[model samples]
Target: MPRLPYLSGVAAATAVVALLAAAPPPSGEVTVSRPRVVAHFDFAQGQTPENIALEPDGSADLTFSAARQIAHVTKQGHTRIRATLPAEANPRTPVVGDDIVLGIARAHDGTLYVTYATGTRKTGVWRVAPGGAPRQIAQLPSNGLPNAIGLDERRGVLYVADSVLGTVWSVPQQGGTPTEWAKDTALDPVPGSEGGFGVGANGLKVHDGAVWVSNSDRGTLLRIPVRRNGSAGPIETRATGLGGIDDFAFTGRGDTVLAAMFLDNELALVRPDGTHTVVLTQEDGLSNPTSVAVRHRTVYVTSGAFFTMRDPNLLLADLGERHDR
Candidate 1:
């Protein structure tokens, strides 16, 4: 999804929230993280970290969206470019007209997969093998905006969320022809910035036995079960009141979610019962937090600074801190 500058969308978002003001009741008590900045980015160099895939060794693979590149960052904050994507020839993209990379996922064998959206001939999913060049594995719709990607390692398949077209596509982990895995009005963008590119289904994750998706425009999280026949089952609205949600990751604590709300500059702790709490915010060095990844008791958050256009960074927080309420 082409992002709106924080300046342009804040007032509109505030007005919308004021008119539809309601919060979900908290499910129960839970401990949250206190975030601290670990690494910073320079926007002029196109170093915005859009999504993250953590390695077994604690390093991170990131999609530098708008940079058209995939990069890696060490646990100690050292960063380097892995591969730069091909330039879009006819760069007329929908929404913000950016021909950039979006989501990324790392395979168990260290093979890295990323999504590119140019709204042109180059829009597709690309694979970057270990010590190899990036190659296109699946061709998505040029008119659609493919955002976050999720890997089902057990099934050897990948699921992509199309924010513009409101569809979730399925492709082989090794790259093949894409298939429309699921379609519903529930995934369509009906609110927020950009008329044609409201960008509904922005983030995706294949957790447990279902494909979990975040609807940015509708302010809800959805879960679609994968049936025994490998087809999409029923769609369930898992959470609500998350107006500007972008990408999210599940913590080890049994179905709990840590989500990034880029539009609101907030990190939310969403529980299994669809209730959530604002655990971190702009005060925690967040400038439009985009993605979240969890490893043990540590949480990784990527802030692209798309709205602030300043101080794009990686923030870390330690979990397991309990607060009774």
Candidate 2:
């Protein structure tokens, strides 16, 4: 196991709440049925809200990648900083060019685990307890771009998806060296990805006794069996054709998923049968949505606005009568 770095004595920042307005739905899409916006970014809050985790009280904890902070959103639609990443955690590599926090997941006990990259070579995961400074938990490989994370609390393990390396890694919940749990050709980048990022295994989730992941470039969803012996088994394709899939959450129905299609500027409802429905689109006011979180029948989405970095927002809508089980 690699030696874990102790990040201590980093000054924590005070929480900042911002006043925001309800974003009107995009004009032309008015006739098209889709999820409506409940909360939109005020720009005074933060930019590039990435991944979100649902709190016990039904609020959401969001990662603001560009701002390098974790924010909490109340169920009633208010936003505030929950924690801030220390300067040392920011990556300084040329490949990625900027320090960005990508994925966040909450444990049952309320600890938040985050994946961040300063560059491809400086990727790591941090654990942040409520009202505490972030602590480095594991250091990923220098060549891997750590993105989304998933927790298997029952097994006391954490799973991280490395988009650049096309691999999934497992780390001890208590903090230790990460091991490559699974990798396959299906996790590779699809031909002709626009950006140099080459995103492969992006979003991750542990559900139904398996580890599910999405390949952003390929837009493929796959699952790896978790054996009784605590090892990962063969990988299997669950669904595909979800272009530019980023972070996603499972829907109320088994085998159904709500995914954020980043490049397509849409929200997608995908099933194991390879059929997908565009629940929201650019015309519906989604601008480069990077993540999705579902709590009961309501769905929350974060638009990073990566291209323009303008009008980035957190949108919400109820899972109404449209979806099929």
Clashing pairs in 2: 91-118
**Candidate 1: deviation at residue 79, Å?**
0.6
The number of the candidate with the highest TM-score is: 1
lDDT against the true structure, per candidate, is 0.84, 0.74
List where candidate 1 sits over 4 angstroms from the true fold: 5-29, 191-197, 321-325
lDDT of 1 by residue, 159-181 (tens): 99999888999999977899999
TM values, all candidates: 0.92, 0.83
> How good is model 1 by TM-score?
0.92
- Candidate 2 TM-score over all chains jointly: 0.83
Worst-scoring 10-residue span by lDDT in model 1 = 15-24
C-alpha lDDT (0 to 100) for residue 69 of candidate 1: 85
Off by over 4 Å in 2: 1-34, 42-46, 88-90, 93-95, 120-122, 190-197, 322-325
* lDDT, candidate 2, 1-325, per-residue tens: 0000121111011111121233442332211244666567744544568888999888999888867789898867688888887654545532355677778999988999998777644468999997788988898876667888899898999999888787899999989899988988787664433432366888899899999999976768898999998788999988877666888888757877888887667787676576676668777778778888887767888887764346777787776443323
lDDT of 1: 0.84
